[model samples]
Target: MKLEPFLLEILVCPQCRAPLNEADYDGHPELVCTAADCGLAYPVRDGIPVLLVDEARRPV
Candidate 1:
């Protein structure tokens, strides 16, 4: 599914509050995160955040 503009507006890297782009797809890599500034990512599951700093990874 395509991301909504408002969702994008409110979304931040969570790790660095940089910016977030679509990172993964449904049942794919799972987490949808991006942080070009900090070079970090945050994972989302079932539309919920994993929120664990260790769980975050660099977007592939």
Candidate 2:
């Protein structure tokens, strides 16, 4: 799945309000928070981003 560049530019982490970086986790697309203190990973399902804090993966 591909997210539009404009959308990606505007998308931020719901928890930290930091920029999100596109990444692949376990072969699945994800949006990872750029904040070092809040490294949450939001999953991308069916080409749509799930930005809810409860659904995010906590940093290991």
Residue lDDT tens for model 2, 1-60: 788999989999988799999999889999999999999999999999999999998878
- What digit string (tens of lDDT, one per residue) describes model 1 on residues 1-60? 345778767877656666566565444433344544565556566666565668876544
Which candidate should be chosen as best, given lDDT against the real structure? 2
Compared with the true structure, the alpha-carbon lDDT of candidate 1 equals: 0.59
What lDDT would each prediction earn against the true structure?
A: 0.59, 0.93
Q: For each candidate, what TM-score against the reference?
A: 0.55, 0.93
Error of 1 at 16 (Å): 2.0
> Which residue segments of model 1 deviate by more than 4 Å?
1-3, 25-37
Candidate 2 has a TM-score of 0.93
Candidate 2: the clashing residue pairs are none
